[model samples]
Target chain A: MGGMKKLINEPADVVSEALRGMGAAHPDRLKVDLENRIVYRKDAPRAGKVGLISGGGSGHEPMHGGFVGLGMLDAACAGEVFTSPVPDQMMAATKAVDTGAGVLHIVKNYTGDVMNFEMAAELAAADAGTEVLSVVTDDDVAVQDSLYTAGRRGVGVTVLLEKIVGAAAEEGRPLQEVADLAKRVNDNGRSMGMALTSCTVPAAGKPTFELAENEMELGIGIHGEPGRQRLPLAPAKEIAAMLVDPVLGDLPYQQGDSVIAFVNGMGGTPLLELYLMYNEVQQLLDRAGITVARSLVGNYITSLEMAGCSVTLLKVDDELVRLWDAPVNTPGLRWNA
Target chain B: MGVENFTNWLRDAASTLHENAAYLTELDSAIGDADHGSNMDRGFAAVVAVLDEVSFESVDELMKKAGMTLVSKVGGASGPLYGTFFLRFGTALAGAEITPATVGEALKAGVGGILARGKAELGDKTMYDAWAPALDAYDDAVAGGADLGGALAAAAEAAAKGRDATTPLVARKGRASYLGERSAGHQDPGATSTTLLLESAARTLA
Candidate 1:
């Protein structure tokens, strides 16, 4: 557990201070509105482009927030740790970024994120008369029981969806088309995670759950919730299999499918371990006869200081591969931009 | 009761939630992401701030503002569920006489909004578990010719009982449902907070 070892000035100011730092760090590509806790592209409301906005809790740093920039999100809303952004913030962001091409809201399928985005869409449409479309991503294989009303969570696939769908939006696609692409990206992807240590929310100032030295939690989410099952710690190869097997089974990626593989680090993990895990993931996919079209391995989406990793596999066509390889300039992820 | 009393209820709920924030969060930590306490505490605090800044002419205005505050300040399923509760509760009280029967009606309206918004049934192990029994108890007490205070007390008691009853049930809604059977042992934090608010209303609203 991190206890009070976090490099923060105060627990309450963590989100605000971090937002300030991001604004300072990315002045060229991003313009962060501190008042509303929104991060926007430096030159936003691009006249004829369909706007893309996605946000959730704040602790999943470099996610919805850091992904805001050219060829990605136009704006991102930041909420409290593990809490969804309120409607007012989202509504404001929706209004600010609408350029008559309308806006597409990429929402995670969590209860809070759904409701907040729902309310914001209503307010933006009713109050501001801005057309907004929303696509909810719920691809976590951990919540396999579709009958469960809470639904599968949005995990690493969210990062991939934002990038791929952002390219479509930047290509001047209409709101409905962009939203459809977002949904398609969601439908073709699946994720599963495990944690070696619990994440401590700075506000909570303690680990969410306790796990002994040899135990690892399986089926964890990015919100700092303890995983569904606890098992003894294993080597990198075995852990990668635990994550990859469910994702492959749920999407049921066939023997000849091509996938954009993502092995995400849960904040506290090192890049070295992430690469090792990615290596294992590649080997598993090779044996399963699934082709890896592209791969991303890093702390892209994360829980705060939870030493873990989640694997996301997106079944992709040529279009998705091109979009994934598109030019993007954001604080957290950028390539050839 | 007048709008002043309703205003005081929000204030009282804020203070109570602030005091029990840690305990409520601990309860959530068991089956949830451990945020209900801070979320509720921040929400009620925002409500209290609104109450400090503006005076309401009717219970509708007061409660609607509080609902919006909670919705804007608290950012989870609780924001929409509880926010709709207060919103419908206040909307039901519009231009109506404030009596035991009307208040009970307003409570029902509010809980109905929660049911509609949350899409949760009686035994889903959510705050609805507490609110379902609380509504029935309030109406039963009101029908038995109880005063406002008496009926509210009965509702508070029923809410407490319902909160306790959530301990052994599997959660079927919200984040807790992700735990499945693992969610059975821990008490629902939303239920506990709902009980606390009802107890506050019982103590102050009358």
Candidate 2:
């Protein structure tokens, strides 16, 4: 098979070089810890304010690391391509970003991430007396067997949670309140993903997983895992039906219930396709009688350069809607703040 | 285990990771995202660098420093998992010369630390696959009157077998677990590196 195409100069240096690029690009807002592989806001640990930190594997750009700035994560630890960051990096991040107001870790519910973040929180508590609270996001509806596989993969809602919770932290909310808000976002959201093609990790110099040109995987995870079902290629409207049906079915979203509909691209997909998918998604929600309160369409959480998309719908209330509208400044999502 | 021996083992482990990083990444490429080798290599090199700066009066101090270095330097899952193993293991040792009996206790503590942190059981298809059997092998060897070196060697062998065994099992945890049954047919990179760690311990401590 032919090698996968990448925008990077060298596959081996993707993570480190990307950090350098990000540092050079966003000098004022962020600082990259080359040795520790952490990205922290320039003004970190705002005194007596809760610190929010999140991270996961690389390849999903503008995620945990890119979102580190004002009204977002205090620190973002970058792991290798699609792998969870280790404990020490997390510990340092927790310590670095803590300013007597305590620290909160926003972990996506991958097993390694949960485990490593848990260890880091413990170490921070034992060593520095840093009060650390971890709230895990498992908003993906693709996986039903919550008893295993760390429940479900935390998908796009995590991005929304980080923003909402970050604003609360900036407003000096206590750790408990911040954590509670994070959980609310998690509970209100459900996402399902599908992939048309696989992505390549530079270090691997090959595709992480394979999908036939005419075949697509549904209910797929972000790490290029085979989905719940593999079916022949279908029209965008049909694919939208496949993706949105299960999410709606599982959540029992009633008619007139307000929600934030997010149609996310999985890296390789273009805006044209995402917009097309979004239009289809809106129609499906209309048919289901679910009211769309707010809508975001973009590649917020991606699987490298895979040709795919995931639909995340957050059942929103008045408080979350206000939080969502609040001004925020981060590399990935920038608003008035 | 003496400080020098432990440090040397760490150095050797680092070297092995650096050399076989591509191989490890290759395995991950098949079923994972392909950073296992590089992440482990980067983390361990930092660990070796720490060995020179710290003065250790006992095994606990040495292991603690190693864990700290790994946590701080390594960016990926291997760093935290291995770092926790050493930190918890060192805490269990608590400033003593490690005897076979005490080392067994230390290993058990490290394994438990991983379990508590990762929440992965036997069939989770993670680094735990290698670690669980290695601890069991260490216990069995000690009970059979094997010396520390002999027991570690047995443990290392068990770890390798366990690592290979991950190839057929469906991953029930971690990122690979996201693949469900498709995660089978590829050896787990975490388990493979874990076996190397045990091998390093056996060679250095012996």
Candidate 3:
């Protein structure tokens, strides 16, 4: 197998084993429904609080699952590596998390995810009469209709939206209001990702694709799909510029615009390189005269062990900045109580 | 054709998928997430287990159980697509006596369910590429007074041709479509697997 060595005991057991570890590691903060493969807050379905749910393939650690708690998602359904969760799991999560106010499904813009979530929402509505709203994040500017063939993909912006919208829900906003805030976040945000190496899906027992040591994939998706373009590997500054330019140009963030700058690492990347990339990204933003009102730098969303990073810039006003600063206590991200 | 032949068909499909699992995954590696073979292999294995565990009175009952097994066990796009295909096919055949013409109708309904679920059209370079032509050929054979075995043979041949025809076509759907022109020149994994299903039907359903 031509890939990084994984610690998994068996390929089929990876997701379930990881879920078990997560439940043990964070007993007080989160609860695991092993049968449904859902990760829920310890005290989910907060009365009158609109529940937030997001899920996707399993490789992206600390994403939907790691973000579940205090100010983020109420629950997250996990699928097998690089596969969308089935509708039965999502429907179970939806009914489990709905607090009678409503539930919101934060879906990434992948075909399987979209279809499965849509089916779950319909089932939830028919079975329990739970009002469910969905917002699909499609902020990746790398491949629009042409390259992706599935409009634009949701990327780094999903983490920021989950946080911001989670805050709005925490304040007891109605489902519609919280969903609208999520849409605003998605609309204002644009992201671009690039990969230096391909990630392995465990069951496949190898890397999804291969890249020569001297080459890199630009505009890559989180699933390890090939990017829009491949080029010779460049320095951190050039890579940062390559990621930032499209994000800024696609949304046309202008001078004096306040924005949240997120520099996210794919799973295999280290913080040292992320900080280096962030430093270059910040300089580019400074030169463009866009004010970075809030910033996040880490591996918030990932593609197995792919070595790369994505940049998301969301134009924000004071309200979003306030929400971004709100207290969030989760396994992955934490702030003041 | 009777329920015994259908049972044998399911067993043969499991064997065929097991034999071709590596090949399917290899094709998927070129244009998709590289799990099609393993997913289908695991799903059909589960179906065989279910087939061994219980006896069903009707063909629809057997097929529905297999479809449910696929939906629960296979955890990718193929899980839902192929699962729905069998479920709808079985549903269309509910309480009906097995016949060549009815098999053609059941396949048509099954492929239609895939279209409704995956929403891919002709020339999208997906399983529909093979399914649409295979269904047409089956219908044509049945209309010409061919029996179940003859129609399935025609369908399997058409599906194989359609699977080969997928090469050199730009994908417009599924994960492969993300590669744009790069997706060309690679045979689609879904079509390959669809061909396998048809070939098994031709061999064992007769």
Leading candidate by DockQ:
1
For every candidate, give the share of true A-B contacts it also has.
Answer: 0.71, 0.57, 0.49
Top-TM-score candidate index = 1
lDDT of 2 by residue, A1-337 (tens): 5976778787667888989889889998998898888999988879988999999988788798888988889999998878788777888999998888889999998766877788788879999999998899898887777666657888888988998888888889999999989998888888999999987777777776677779998887787656767899999999999889988887768888899999999998999999999999999999999989889888888898889899988898888888888778878988886
Segments of candidate 3 deviating more than 4 angstroms: A1-4, A146-148
lDDT of 3 by residue, A1-337 (tens): 4455899899989999999999999998999999889999999979999999999889999887999999999999999888888888888999998879999999998877887788789889999999999999999888767443766888898999999999999999988999999999999999999999988878887788889989999988898788868899999999999999988898899999999999999988999999999999999999999999989999999998999999999999999999998989999889976
Query: lDDT of model 1 at residue A236?
Result: 91
Summing lDDT over every window of 10 consecutive residues in candidate 3 chain A, give the lowest-scoring window: A142-151
Alpha-carbon RMSD to native, per candidate: 0.9, 2.7, 1.6
* DockQ for all candidate structures vs. native: 0.80, 0.47, 0.59
Task: In model 2, state the lDDT of residue A1.
Answer: 59
What is the TM-score ranking, best to worst? 1, 3, 2
CAPRI grade, predicted model 3: medium
